[model samples]
Target chain A: MIRLKVALAMAAGIAAISSAPAFAAKAKSEEKADAAPIAIPAPPPGKGQIVFFRPGGMGFALGCSVNENGEKISSLGAGRYFILVTEPGTHQYSVKSEAKDTLGLLVESDETQFAKCKIKMGIVAGRPDIQPATEEEFRKQKSLKLVDEDDMGPAPGALRPAEIAAALAQAPAAE
Target chain B: MLAIFVATILSAAAVEAAAPESDGVSSADATEMVLSASLPEGGKAPLSDDPESARRDITIPKLTPISIQILKPLGSKLSKTGETFPIRLAAPILVNGVEAVPAGTEGMGEVIHAKKSGGMGAAGELVVTARYLDVDGRQLPLRSLHWAQSGQSRVDTVNTLNVASAASPLPIGLVGFFIGGGQINVAEGALADAKTAADFSIALPQVSSQQAGTGQELSEGDLAVPSGAVPDEAVDTESAAADVHQGGKE
Candidate 1:
């Protein structure tokens, strides 16, 4: 009788040990399967970049981009105009006119949509400090952060209304 | 209960993993850049009400950045005794890309000029043209033209004449409208005819308005207000301000 009782106790211990891992794994897997989902938001919009500028900024010049676009894209030009709105990708651009010439690259964003940008008319040559703005140069511009060079009279690139009017007063007849 | 909890957590984790992929772009969180610039109105002319021509044909070319001060010297007609008299008819000048003068500019019909049909002479109508440029000096393509403003009024027919050229995406050019209708005729005898002409000069951005007596007419009281001044637009926004703040390096 004593031997039988001992044997039964041993058998019960073995059964308990074998069942533990299976139960634990089942519980874990079930929890994983029932977990709640996470919420995700929508993507953002795209943007534009300035590609080029004239060497001697003065009368007129040119530039390029894959930035802005759409209806009323240009308030100045009320028509359907837009910049290339795309992911962060590279594009080719150029400028060639009777007065001047230029070339550059455009990097766009992939996450959002882009629109047509208002192209800056390349200015002619006259000013000494006026230099063309290239993609590489623009990169430096972002770093140094010269909002508008104010060392000069009204400051470089800064045109006062009176000055504009004066330019008007002194504007030579059409070429 | 524990099983249920564990299952819920696992499911939640899976869901989280599936989400956050709305943008496949690596720099999805980049800054929002807005590239806005002023442009010209070109391409096709607006349709008019003329029957002979289905399109109210208007052609605009991109005008360069040039400035001119308009001066109007009002002259009158006279009788045999040399007495001043009001003339009945008056005609407007026409040209391409010339905007209307803002307040404080010399006088009405100051260097007035406009004509759609080539701009050299008047076709008994007013026309305008202009170009658009960005703050950075980039220009729109010649193909994309829309509309542009010249700080002028278009509705006033009889007395006040102000007009801006319509533009498109490209800075084709601008031509403006002026006074029209009939010529200002003088009475049978006195001062032949009361002609309207502006005696103004053109200058570059370098000229000093003060030296040119522009201050005298500036109406400081009214001009100080920005209501009439040209608007300054912001440049295009750069990318990823948000991301830069996060995982991006300093």
Candidate 2:
């Protein structure tokens, strides 16, 4: 009982430390002292809307850019956003998480069997290193006899290390 | 390709931000920046081309030389077997080069009692949870909790500057793994000292004899110990050399 009380007390103290006015003051002062020159994300162009899928946990949305057709894409907008560049054609998208990483997508017009993927984790098929799966890659995996993602929660007691990869995705781009 | 490129950032430490010859920003801005500024993707992700990403990556080059060590428990409290040696330790954690984790912040490594070894074969069994700092001095939560940004204005920015601007970091937590017959080769209590090997030791936490109130086992539903901690044996320096050497092999 005492240990529990102590643990609880410590937790409360940490909570107080996180919110106390004095601590806040110190953190604020420290923030000023520690401030470094940073590059704020360039503002969004009037044309495209950047999107965000909630990071981790029950919330999962990358919050990519919205295309003219109201399709979600990741582009132009800055701020730790993913994706290199998408095709010019209109694209519809959703997310397929393999392990943990997430991404955005661009599709080739009218070619739907499996065109491209934009996610954080997926199998590369013949490729060994794990990558994110885009819609296209999903199709490719389907085509190549790879297992489909369960889309369900992990089994009870599974070791969740944090979690994934992929396409319309060669890598990070520089402007 | 880019994924591999980023993962390739296995090495390379960002020089720390120098402490202010001046102090100005308030914690609000600091919290806002820390919370809002976009964190480059990936907890272990690489530093991006963005200066902000680079600035965030600024760390005292760690994750190297800090090899994880697994030590076997002493055969019996009264007597023992094995060699003990000194292993270099990464600096005790610092948030912006400041030491914050007070003494006893670390309760020794987890203790495994009775039942035969659970570690590598033959090696007696015990689990070692080496505390480390990978998450920019800040300890990210283990359990997921809602960090509502709705009320908080978010500002995600990274600042890259010459070596002078990077700040030191804090020691994060440790991960536990089962290893038997091995002895940790670190300095005692992870005391801060001149980077000398003498400042090392491995001590595991002691489990109370009365049994943990929660009725939980050591591993998930395995064995149970009391709620409070057990007192560790008087560290034996007499066996230090042999312990270090044997601990290295076993």
Writing each residue's lDDT as its tens digit, candidate 1 over B75-177 gives 2111111122222122221222222222122211111112121121111211111111111132221111111111111222211111112134543322222
Question: lDDT of each model, Cα atoms only?
Answer: 0.24, 0.25
- Candidate 1 residue-wise lDDT, A1-175, digit = tens: 9999999999998888898999999998876664422111112234322222222121223332111221111111111111222233333232223232111222322121111212222223211111112233322221121112222122212232344345336633111
Q: Model 2 has how many clashing residue pairs? A: 77
DockQ of 2: 0.01
* lDDT per residue (tens digit) for residues A1-175 in model 2: 9999999999999988777988779888877654432111211221121222212211123322223233333321112222222232223333333322122222221112111222121122110011122232222221121112232122321111121122113323111
**Best model number under TM-score:** 2
Q: Residue B43 lDDT in model 1?
A: 15
- Candidate 1 Cα deviation (angstroms), residue B117: 42
**TM-score, one value per model:** 0.14, 0.15
